[model samples]
Target: MQVFKEKTLLKAAVKAAKSNAKIIGLVPTMGALHQGHLSLVKQALQECDQVIISIFVNPTQFDNPADLEKYPRTLEEDIRLLKQADPELWIFTPTAKELYGENISAEQFNFDGLEQVMEGKHRNGHFDGVGTIVKRLFEVITPHKAFFGEKDFQQLQIVRKLIDKTGLPVEIVGCPILREENGLARSSRNERLNTFEREEASFIYKTLLKVNELFGTKSAEYIQNWVEGQFKNHQVLKLEYFEIANTQTLEKINRKRKGNTYRAFIAAYVGEVRLIDNIALNNEE
Candidate 1:
C-alpha cells in the first residue's frame, strides 16, 4: 500500500491515477482501522479502480478537549490493519498543520437544520468540523465517489447536505451499519470500552430493536417514555435522548405522516463511554 503524509505527493499520485482514466473512490477516516472501516475500503475497492483513505483525528469536531485527546491514534497498528485488507491501498495521513494550517479550527456552515439535532445538540460545532475537513478532502482528492457508514447517520445526512450545498462533483455512497455479534454498533470508540462496558453496551442496540418493534403499535410518545424507563432502570447505561423523527428533515414528529418515513434514534452514556444507535421503523426509501 502506498501511504502519503504530504498532500503534494498524494496529489501527484492521484493525478497520475486519474491520467490513466481510473475511477477514484475516497474513504475518509480518523485512523484506528476497524472491521467496519475496512468494509468501507473493501466496498470502494469493488467499485473504483483506486481508493484513498484519509486518516486524521480532527480537533474542532470535539467540543470536549479531553475527548479529542483520548481519541485513538494507533497509526502503526492502523497501517498494519490496512495492509491486511489491501496492500495496494492509498492512505493519506496528514497533520493538522499540513491539512489545514497552523491555526486549525472548524468553519461555520448551515446544513439546513440537518446539523441542529441529535449529535449537533450534544456536540457543538461537530458538523462544521466535519464539513471543514470533508470539504478539504473532497477538494484535495476530487474522487468520483465517497463512501460513508450509516453508524453516524446524522453525520451521513449532514454530509449529503454538504455536497448538495457546495455542488461538489462527487457521489456520497451510504453503506449499511455494521454491528458486533452482541448487537453493539461497530465504532472506533469501541476500543476504549471495557469488557463489561461492551457487554452492557449491547443493551443499547437491543433497546433500539425493541423500539423498532414497538413503533406504529405503540404511540411515539409511549415509545419515548418506554425507552426512557428502560435506560432509567439500567444499572450501567444512561439514556441521553430518544426520538422518533421524520427521516427526511430530521424534525421531531409526534405522529408519523402517511407516505413519510421515520426512524428510532437513541444516544446514551455507558459510564464515560457514550454510544449512539438507530433503527428503521419501517421499510427504507
Candidate 2:
C-alpha cells in the first residue's frame, strides 16, 4: 500500500525488488480504478513476487485536449481500492511534470502500419501518446512482465511491437476484457454513463457477438456491411469503425484465407463516452 510519486524513488524501489531476486510485475493504468483494473492487478499478484501499478493519467496520450482534461483522476480512492487487494502493493502515482517534464508530448514511433488504422485512423497521435507513456513506465518500473486488457487489442499489439522494436525485457501479458452483467465492456469511461446509457452501451458487445456469429458463413464485406447497418438503425450507440482483421498483421480480412486467424473489432460512441471492444472470431487468441 506504499505509494511512490517520484520516478527516482520508484526506480530505487524496483531496484531493491530486483536485488532481492523478486519477480516484478507492472500494471500500468490511468487511474479511475474499477473492477477491470483490479483484475489485472490480481493476475500480476498471482504470477509475480511483487506488483507495481502506475496510476498516472498520461497527458500526451490524448489527441484531444478536452478529452485529457475531462479524463477521470481518483487517486485516493484508487489507492484505497488497490489496498483492499494487496496491502503491500507498490503504487507509482507520478504527476505529468514529474514524469514527462514541463513540455509534455508523445514520442512518435513507426509500428510498421500498426498505428495507421482504427483507433489510430480516427484519433491522430493517440498511439504515440500511448507509446510514450507506456515506454516511460517500462523504463521506470522495470517489471518482469506488464499486464494490459485486450479491450485495447490494437494497443496491446503495438506494445508487443514496442518490446520487439526496443528490445525491452518485460513480457506483455494481455488479459481478458472484463464486462458488466449486460455485456458492456468495463471501462473507466463507463463512469460517465447514466443508468440507461450504460445499458444501451451493451449494444457494442452484442454487435461484436453478432459479427462473430456471422464470421464463417458471411463474407468479411457482408459482416462489415451488417455491422454498419446495425449501428445505423440503433438509436443509442454511434459506430465508429468495425473491422474483421487477421490477428497478426491487423490488416482487414477481405476474404477468408485458409489457416489464418481472425478477430472482430469495434468502436462506438454512446453519447460522449467512446467505448471499444473486440472478440476472437475463433478459439485462438
Candidate 3:
C-alpha cells in the first residue's frame, strides 16, 4: 500500500488512479483503526474500484484539549492493520499543518438546527471541526463515494448536509454500526476504558436495545425516563442525554408519527470516557 503525507503528492497519485477511469472510494478517519473503521474500508472495497483511507487526528473537531491530546495516534500499528486488512488500500496520513497550514481556524457550518442539539450542545464547535476537516478531505480525494459509519449517526447526518450545502459531487454512504459480541458499539475511545468500565459501557447499547423494543408500547417521555433510570442503576455510567427523535429532522418527538422515521439517541460517560449509541425504533418505509 502507498502512503502519502503531502496533499500535492496524494492528489497527483489520485489523479493517476482517476486517469484509468477507476471509481474512487474514500474513508476519512482519525487514526485508531478498529473493526468499526475496517468495516467502512471493507464496504468501500465492495463498491469501488479503488479505496483511499485518510488518517489524521483532527484537532479542530475536539472541543476539549485533553480529549484531543489523549486521542490515539498509533501510526505504525494503523499502517500494520490496514496492510493486513487490504493490501491494495492507499493510506493518507497528513499533518495538521499540511491541511490547515500554520494557522488553524474552523469554517463555521450551519446545519439548520442539527448542530445545536445532543453532541453540539455539550461539545461546542465539534461539528464545525468535523465539517472543516471532512470538507478539506473531500477536496483532496475528490472521490466518487465517501463511506462513514452510522455509529456517529449525527455526524453522518451532518456530513450529508455538508455535501448538500457545498454541492460536492460525492455520495455519502452510511455503513451500519459494528458492535461487540456483548452489544457495546465499537469505538476508538473504548480503548481507554478499564476492564470494569468496559463491561459497564455495554449498558449504553443495552439501553438502546431496550428503547427499540419498548418504542411501540411506551410513550417517548416514558422511554426517556426509563433510560434515565437505567443509567442511575449503573454507578460508573453517567447519563448525558437520551432522545427519541425524528430521524430526518432530529427534533425530539412527543408522539410517534406513523409516516415519519425515528431513532433512540444516547450519550453517557463510563468513568471518564464518553460513549454514544443509537438504534432504529421502527422500519423506515
Candidate 4:
C-alpha cells in the first residue's frame, strides 16, 4: 500500500486516473482500523478498480475538545491493518495542519431537516464539522464512488445530502453495520472500554434488537421508554438518547406508516467512551 501525507502527492498519485478509465473508490476514516472499517474496504475492493483510504482525525468534526483529544490514533498499526485488508490500497494520512491549515473554515450546508434530529439534536455543530471534512475530501479525491458504513446512520444520510447539494459526481454507498458475535457494534472507541464496560455496552445493540421485535406491536414512545429502562438497569451504560425514526428522513415516527421504513437510533456512554448503534425496524424483512 502506498501512503501519501501531502495532498499534492496524493493528487499526483491520482493523476493516473487521467490515463486509465478505472473506477476510483474512497473510504474516508479516522485511523484505528477495525473489522467494521475493513468491511467497507472489502466492498470497495469488490466494486472499484482502485480504492483510496483517508486517515485523518478531523478536528472540525468533534464537538467536545476532550472527545477529540481522546479519539484513537494508531497509524503504524492502522497501516499494518490496511496492508492486511488490501496490500494495493492507497492510504492518505494528512496532519491537521496539512488538511485544515492555521485558519480553518468550513462551508455551510443546508441539509433541510435532515441535520436537526437525533445526533444533530444532541451534538451541536457535529454534522457541520462532518460536512466540512467530507466536502473537502470529496473535492480532493473526486472518486467515482465512496463507501460509508451504516453504523453512523445519520452521517450516512448527511453525506447523501452533501452529494446532492454539491452535485458531486460520486455515488455514496452505505454498507451494513458490522457487529461482534455478542451484538456490540464494532467501533474504534470499543478499544477504550474496559472488559466489564465492553460487555455492558452490548446492551445498546440488544435494546435495538428489542425495538425491531416490538415495532409493530408497541408505540414509538413505549419502545423508547423500554430502551431507557434497560439502560437504567445497567448503571454502567449511560443512555443518552434513543428514538424510533423514519429511516429516510430521520424524523421521529410516532405511528408506523404502512410502507414507510423506520429504524431505532441510539447513543449511550459505556464509561466515558460514547457509542452509537441503530437497527432497521419495519424494513428488516
* Candidate 2 structure quality by residue, lDDT tens digits, 1-285: 789989998899889889999999999999999999999999999999999999988877788889989999898899999999999999998888988888797898999998998899999999999999999899888899999999999999999999999998999999999999999889999999999999999988888888888885888888889999999999988999999888888998878877898889999998988989999996322
Sort by lDDT, best first.
3, 2, 1, 4
Clashes of 2: 1
Measured on C-alpha atoms, candidate 1 has an lDDT of 0.89
lDDT of 2 at 199: 94
Estimate the TM-score of every prediction. 0.97, 0.97, 0.98, 0.96
lDDT tens digits, residues 104-200, model 1? 9888999999899998998888999999999999998899999999888888888999999999999999998899999999998888899999999
Error of 4 at 181 (Å): 1.8
Q: What local lDDT score does residue 203 receive in model 1, on the 0 to 100 scale?
A: 97
lDDT of 4 by residue, 1-285 (tens): 899989988887787864588789999999899999999999999999889999999887777899989898999999999998889999999887787888676556779889889888888888888999998888888888999999999999999998889898989999999998889999999999988888888988888887888986888788778888888888788888998888889989867777789888999987788899999886533
Q: Which stretches of candidate 3 lie over 4 Å from their true place?
A: 283-285
The models' CA-based lDDT, in order, is 0.89, 0.91, 0.91, 0.88
TM-score quality measure for candidate 4: 0.96
- Candidate 3, TM-score vs. the true structure? 0.98
lDDT of 3 by residue, 1-285 (tens): 999999999899889989999999999999888999999999999999989999999999999999999998899999999999999999999999999998787999999988888889899999999999999999988999999998899999999999999999999999999998888999999999988888888888888888888887888889888988888888788998999878878898988866899988999987778999999887432
Residue 236 displacement (Å), model 3: 1.4
lDDT of 4 at 202: 90
